[model samples]
Target: MRLQDLSAALSDLESNHRLRRRATLASPQGVDIVVDGQSYLSFASNDYLGLADHPALALALQQGVERWGAGSGASHLLTGHSEAHQRAEEALARFVGREAALLFGSGYAANLAVITSLVGRGDAVFADKLNHASLNDGCLLSRADFQRFRHNDMAHLEQLLAASAARTKLIAVDAVYSMDGDEAPLPALLALAERYDAWLYVDDAHGFGVLGGGRGAAAEHGLASERLIYMATLGKAAGLAGAFVAGEGLLTDWLVNRARTYIFSTAQPPALAAAVETSLRLIEEGDERRARLAQLAARCRERLDGTRFAGGASRTPIQPFIIGEDAHAIRLADSLRRQGYWVPAIRPPTVPENGARLRISLSASHEPAQLDALLDLMLQASG
Candidate 1:
């Protein structure tokens, strides 16, 4: 496209209230941050366990830098993989109860690697309609006979799986829906995968380090199986960088050999992996933090139950108050910002059309007074 055409397209996005902008954070990931020279009580981070700024993790990173330097300097197939990376991979495998695990640059890269490496032109891939964009992109890039069932509709998923005649079938879903804050019915999905003899791939990016006593949705639901491929990001609740895909030994080996993204991309910094090791230890023992987070979530839900900004049935920290119009959601977010709160306005294509919302991501680091104050602000703004 021409430069003028690109500018016109940008103008169209702005006119439709869909133009996205980046926020400059002048502080670390925490409940309080300085953004664009203004301080705010932020509720827009994915640091659910509040380990993003933990001292222990910081110390671990420093130790790692002293030992392994800052960067991996190459891809895993080359000299990039370090002892730190290997330890993290082994730790992740144990945490998720998988036979083997492989690290990737990010959750997106891991999903792309899994979907593309496992299935090809003659195979079939079934996905949830509300799966993350990365999952959808993986399906499309795989060149498989891709099919999307309705969101969380197991009956539809079963129907699709039963009707498919491909030599290989893969069912991909998110353990927890990012935007809606609801969980996938893993038991039912696993049964369907078994009945149809297909692989079940789950992206637990939002569930890991926050669910199942910090083991993630698979452990929370007791849905582990040989056919399950579990992928989780470390950047969210683990408060670190990168992602890992865990599965049986053969599958993990296949991904390491065939997944182009993993093969070609530079390995993540060894210092980050060392820090992630500390984060994992914290997550495993963070019962008090999780309990506090649950209390805070319940309080927020109860306070907003009868309000216009009520959220869905989410037991997780990701509570989203749906606002139908883009402008209205933006206005509410702006109002919250003006009041020193930093809940973000989530709009399409991040969400579906008419599903714009205020994505309130809670953290264990958030104080009770902050939650109460946010509830009060929400009521006032909605009114």
Candidate 2:
């Protein structure tokens, strides 16, 4: 509890190669950034559609700030929620085919609100083993009997569902695994949830604006919105801030009333909501960007497929090359940085032990020449 104890804990983390350090960004969130006064071709960001620095989105934010000022100044339940927020929530609900939607400060808080609000102590919550940390924390907060099925393994989920107490069970998963860049078997999971009369909650943070022609995983697979809860972050492919939870009216109403994260936190600035709305509109109409990005990702994977450093099977903008050890991953990332590419090292806790990797993220803004340069540097680094 003492500061000395905290320092000792930090030391322990560093010793175990689990300490996290911060990176300085001298540019806006986008395909390229300036760090330490040097420009780097960034492949470590989540701005998949490359709208983070989009001119239209910036204009919208500027106009919104002029109209709505800088802050919401309160929570939604208070006086914080503005007309911009309301319209953006409605727009997102319609985009995702949901009856209603509620905006949260971030995706992490939105997951916390949904799980804790829906599942109670006597209920059961089933989750994917490789789901985002927020969902894992949500289950912990629910105080319910938490169960994790094998990653993307529907059979294991079904088995767990069959043997569950048949109480109110909620199955939670990420539509696409963030670190692994693989999609969940959503159809199978939805079928099982229906058979067991359980609610299915999906966090599509990485899928929205990057999948389903930019509508996300549920739309990609033509799944309806009934008895299903979907949450997505705007900061990823949308290149904006905040998150939204979309579902039927009752589900959203319940969250508005009971979800502590939404009730207690200051609403995201109206300017951010406007910017996100703009980004969503562009994503819906920017099919060419999506296609180009997908093609680029596929090309990168194809070129790296047989290499010893490549860990293939990634179909999304996120690609990871395994290095087995933390030091090796760090070394490779450093080497890539020296070659002018800004790739980040993924270590344990973000990933599992011996699963350290270089998380290569692609953006629509990146050119073929950049990709070629990246590959050349990476191949040389591997050697």
Candidate 3:
């Protein structure tokens, strides 16, 4: 509890090779970043659309600041929620084909709001083994009878659902597995949920603004609004910040009333909400950007023809190259950094042990020459 004890714990983290370092980016987030004063090609960012440093977003932010000033100063139910927030929420609901939506300060907050609002002490929550940490934390906070099925295994989920004795059952999953870059068997999962008479909640943080013409995984699978409660973030492919939950009006209203995260946290800045609105517009209209990113991802996959890396099959922008061990993955990341590439090593706790990997995320702004150069480096490294 003391400073020295905290220092000792921090020292232990370094000794165990788990000390996290923050990278300072002098330039805006994009295909490249100026980290520690040196520019490097980036594969670590979630900016799949390459719109973070875009002119439109910049202009929108500037104009938004001029109109809305700075922070929201209080929680949504207080004096914080503005017209901009309402408009952004509405746009997101329409985009995801849901009846209504509610915004949260971040993706973590959105997950907390959804899970806690839906599941409780007597309720059961069945989740994927590999879902994001936010979802895991949400389950814990909800005080639900939390159970995890095998990753993407519907049979296991069904068995768990059949055995559950709770009054309400909630099936929680991610549309895209964050580290593995694989999609959930959404259609099968939805069908199973319906059969078991369970509510399905999907966190489409990675899928939204990247799949189904930027509508998300549920949309990609042609799953309707009634099939699931969806959550999406603006920080990923949308190139913005904050998150939202989209579903039936009653569910959203329930979240507004029951979700502690939404009730307690300070509302996001009105200017940021305005910026998110601009990002949504770009996402809805930028079909060519999405198409080009798909082509780029396919090309990159093709270039990795004969490598030891076992990246799972994913059509999304996130591509993982497994490195087996944490130390080796860190070393490879160091080597890549030395070579002016900015791909970071995904290590244990964030992922399972021996699942350390290089998460190569693509962007529409990546040039052909950059891809060729990266491929050449990968080939040399593989050899």
Candidate 4:
């Protein structure tokens, strides 16, 4: 009976062209990669600054292992928290201009810890419709009155905020929308949070090491307030693993005491923390990489202009070519793959119905000729 049910569900997904498949990577993450023994010019990674395989980061990881070993052997409140972890947290807080910071194993864990710790049965969580899955999951896990406003629509957010009577209200948003590559209106959201007496949570997973000169989206908009709780993942542009939450001293202390994910999960390896510290330094000094990424993204947009493929108004490294139907997007992706590209088809429930797209993620390591070749291939595939 269980096998029958599972088969039925899988059949439904396959019929809809939404059955997800994982690719096997045999090479380091970069513009060029070997997937399942085949080399491809890839645009499917979130390594925006192309630091994932940096020699400095690898060296730091090596030194960290030599100094601290592999595992933490416990949770943060237990015996897991190491000097390297503390130092990384301090560096993250300072980098984001926050009073304090707490590290988590991943961005999902950090979001769960923050939303669940701060809001509960009597409180509320107001989020954007296009927020990352983790944010929505955190809201559901909190058992809070979860309300979703239209994507980047301030009026809808304000309307929801005005209607909510919960004593504690939290506004959660992505600093940069992961799929669309557009940014949230931080200033307006901050203003609304202040007016409504809500806590504003900014998840800077895609923005931290790539935006605001490496400070992030909130910093880009000059938004620094006690009511703001900031989260950033290091695995992307940082070229390391883990995430951190930054906020006021009191708030971080509260999370340290109350966030179950942080209190229960085994602490991340101390060596990773050491590597993240080095990654932070590299990100701060990675202006040239950022510029290269911007140039690549601009070139992509310029070429795609006046084409049916152009989808969103994103100035960032993420460029989506909307194909509307799932099958069409999948076919386009397969066509590109056949021609030695590795762009993936993003389908629902990753996106809304009829909103399947090719998520063209740009990295600084991508060359001009490669970008031009990709443009030609995309045009040919679409044609």
Where is model 2 poorest over a 10-residue stretch in terms of lDDT? 305-314
Tens digits of per-residue lDDT, candidate 2, 1-383, equal 89999999999988877788888898988777898888999999899988888899889999999999999999888899899999999999999888999999899999999999989889999999999999999999999999999888888898999999846999999998888888988888889889999999999999999889898999999998477899999988888888999989998989999999988899999988877668878999989899889888888878887887456547898887777788777888888888788998899888888999887888999898898788887777777
Q: Write the per-residue lDDT of candidate 4 for residues 267-293, one digit (tens) a residue.
A: 999999988778988999999999998
TM-score per prediction, in order, is 0.98, 0.97, 0.96, 0.98
Clashing pairs in 1: none
Q: Model 3, stretches more than 4 Å misplaced? A: 225-227, 310-313
Top-lDDT candidate index: 4
How does each model score on lDDT? 0.91, 0.88, 0.87, 0.92
Runs of candidate 4 with Cα error greater than 4 angstroms are: 311-313
| Best of the two (3, 4) by lDDT | 4
lDDT of 1 by residue, 71-124 (tens): 999999999989989998998899889999999989999999999999999999
lDDT-sorted candidate list, best first: 4, 1, 2, 3
Candidate 1 vs candidate 4, lDDT winner: 4
Q: What is the lDDT of candidate 3?
A: 0.87
RMSD of 1: 1.1
Model 4's TM-score against the true structure: 0.98
